[model samples]
Target chain A: MKISILRKKLDDKEISAVELTRLYLDRISAADKLTDAYLYVNYDGAIKAAQSAQTIIDAKQSRPFTGIPIALKDNLCTFDMPTTCSSKMLDGFVPPYDATVVAKLRGQGAVFLGKLNMDEFAMGASTKTSYYKKTKNPYDLTRVPGGSSGGSAAAVSVGLCAAALGSDTGGSIRQPASFCGITGHRPTYGFVSRSGCIAFASSLDQIGPLADTADDCAALLTATAGRDIYDQTTADKTFDLKKSDKGIKGKRFGLIKELMGKEVDKDVSAAVKKAAEWFINAGAVVEEVSLPMLTHAVPIYYLISSAEAASNLAKFDGVRYGFRPEKTLNFFDMISKSRDEGFGWEVKRRIMLGSYALCSGYYDDYYKRAIKLCGIIKSQYAEAFKKYDALLSPVAPTTAYPFDKLPDDPAQMYLADICTVSAALAGLPSLSTPCGYDKDGMPIGLMITGKRFDDAAVLSAAGAYEKEFVRKPPQLKGVSEMKL
Target chain B: MKSDISIKWLGNLSKIKFDDDGLKKMAADMQSIMTLMDSLLLVEPVEFEDGTEFCGLDALRADTVRDSFDPELLVSQAKDSKDGCFVIPKIL
Candidate 1:
């Protein structure tokens, strides 16, 4: 059910908060066996929160998110639940406080279902790198839910939660949401605060929402977005959640010529074309625009993000809150052994790559050059935005693929981020909304990106498309047949 | 180009170690990624156009004293804590 409908039911007292929470927890108990969406299930905590919400509802002091059941990606810190980031490096570490977003949601009376799985330190595109269980696509169990936000998207896809919070470094949120057929939005870089979120690439990481629709994403974003004293990168502006009556009528959208290349699956390209046609038929203008710098977004994003990640991750030296080695020779040896054993292969690989990129001999040739190229990519987006209000492209080159399909080379996997990385590089607001289904009935996502801080406009464009598109839910194995 | 990158040197810089097999695997993976990074050379180093968004230092909130995490709670997550201090290997 949609958040709006849930609100109406909650307000009218058709069901108590406890009953609603129980229903969702039951669904998770049954369905998550196949999906493997949650890392920890906070059954008692959720029930206790539900009781509190019931009291508030009885007192007529309910807020926008009162009684809402939301799951957090494991990267977001929670005081009570473990925020492992699905990595052994943080095997048992729980923060003393909640992340800024989690705090906001809790203050508004949102029930904490559990922590969802994600890529280890948000390193890999597929959640396979997670030290925990791999999250499977609800649409097809054999395939992966795109990651590192795979668990968040999968949970929402299988009705495990009303919505989930996900972090996007390079296509993490949107790619998984696309694979699972949900709406995921990475708000403008600073639209949401990053305080207490386990940093991967500080410059690129933004916590976003994965929901069934754009309006739901807008509601979540509105409730959570604001300037935080803790996160200086947050914008000073407020996210005023007003109705966007300004539909796609007469608005101009650009179809990025670079994104719809031969690399994109024909069905995925077709879906984008169909979305453009829908816009054109709806009295909007659609044009093919070029951003050639986008072709290098993959390399540029990896270089810069890894460089930031290496620095951000230097804190995990085993002395403080994370996993520690039992036997070591000295302080240096302790830290080295702890890290070498604690981190997964992918995490270590990125750290090594990041260290090399920032090394004295290679800094200018790699990191500095990537930053300069990033500037050119951003300028290209600026040029395009001067004419078009938003751009349209496929979320991924293809629909969700079977496990172990890509070659062992990580570059082969990183290259799949071609379409979504540019928006992140430019600090633009990008969203993935289900556009069509592939031959195997897997959903394809059409990415809509707007200029920086034009987040509401980007969401409005997505909401417009969502209103007309018919959404179908995945038939989860044990839970779909059960009537709550 | 791949041979020039020393895995041992990077492992030392990152403070993470690798065995012989792990080193070989890390080297191979590093080579693949570096080859991908080489594509940046294809783009001419055009004049830098600082398109990065900046909130500026002026936007920072005034630093002020406020209640912080309770020391007891902060130290609770540490693997080894005694007398409100994290127990670490003695550097000396």
Candidate 2:
């Protein structure tokens, strides 16, 4: 159900927040076993929060997200719940404070459905690397839902919740949203505060929303965005996200040539092409634009992201908090054993590579070069945006891949990020909406990226395209559907 | 194009032991990947000084009496703790 419709239903007494919360919880109980979408469901706390929202609704205190059920990706800190990033390293770590986004959502009376699963420490493209079980795509059980925000996307797609909050660092949100056939928005980096979110690649990370539709994402962004003193990087500008009938008329859009090449899956390219035709038919000018620098994005992203991840993850030693080693011969042995026992294989791999990249002899050669490449990628987007209002691309190279068929080779796995990394490096607002389905019935997403702090424009373009071109995926049989 | 940096050096720095064969495979893979990255040298260099800025971290004025975390929560997960501190074996 859409948040706006849900709000009207609540206002008319057609539904109570308590009833809505219970309904979602019941749906979660039935569906989550199949999808593995949640790492931890806060049954009691969620009910209590819902009851509080009910009181607010009774008092006639209506807010944008009031009485709406929302799922939080496990990486976002929650003061009242365990904020595990689906890793044993933080298995029982209850943050002393809520993340800024969480605080704002709660203040708006958005019911917390539960904490969803993710790649361990947001490190992998697939949630298979999670210490918990992998999240299965709701559309097809054998296929991956994509990650590290896999669970968030899956939950919203399957109607476990109306919407969800996801962290996008290198396609975590957009990739999963594409795979799950839902709407996900990665706002310009720092548009939403990151205070209290566990740091991964601090510079690259941005909190975003994953919802069933573009308008829902826009509403969630309004509630979750803006500057916070605690998070100095957040933008000071306001994003007014009311439903605008502004069609993409006369706007110039660039179809990134690098993203549309022969390397992309044939079906995926066809779907995006169909969406481009829709844009052109809507009286907008669509032209193919070159961003050759995007070719270097993945490698540079890995270098910088892994280097920062190594430092951010160092704090999880057994001494202060998190998991501890059962036995150790020395202090150094204790720290080493603690980390070795705590982190999963993917996490360990990143930490090792990150440490290597940031090591004394290699710092200037690897980390420094990667930082420079990031600048080039950013400039490429800036130069492109100077001529175009937004850039259109495929969210991923292909639609959702079958769970068992994922490449065992890490490099091949990294290649899945081919089209999405440039926007991440440039810190631009980008979104993925389900454009069309492939022959295999997998959904293809058309990614829309705008200049920095241009979130409203990006979302407006996506909303317009959604209205003109996209068709909602037919509800899968045997999944009990909920009515607003 | 891929070079095999000695495994002994990697093993020493990472504090993980690898057999000669394991070292050879890892080195070969890393070298291949690094060789790919070496292609960046040919691309025109971006003027780094223009847009680069340090983020997240800030040098704020120190607070001497800031609120500290509960000492009990700190050692709550430790396998061994005593008298407000976690006990560790000798390092030196």
Tens digit of lDDT per residue, candidate 1, span B1-92? 34676899899999997899999999889989999998888788789666556652258677789888778788898889998889998888
> What's the residue-level lDDT of A435 in candidate 1?
95
Fnat for model 2?
Answer: 0.25
Question: What's the CA error at residue A55 for candidate 2, in Å?
Answer: 0.8
Q: For candidate 1, give the lDDT of residue A345.
A: 93
For residue A275, give model 1's deviation from the true position in Å: 0.9
Highest-scoring model, lDDT: 1
Tens-place lDDT digits, model 1, residues A390-464: 999999999999987955988998999998899998888999999999999999999999988888777988888
**Candidate 1: which pairs clash?**
none
In candidate 1, which residue ranges exceed 4 Å CA deviation?
A: A243-245, A481-484
- Give the range of the ten consecutive residues with the poorest summed lDDT in model 2 chain A: A469-478
Q: How well is each residue in A160-271 modelled by candidate 2, as lDDT tens digits?
A: 9989999999999999999999999999887799988888998889999999888999898889888687777776656776643365889999999999888899999988
TM-score of chain A of 1: 0.98
TM-score of chain B, per candidate? 0.83, 0.60
Alpha carbon lDDT at A185, candidate 1: 97
The alpha-carbon lDDT assigned to residue A221 of candidate 2 equals 84
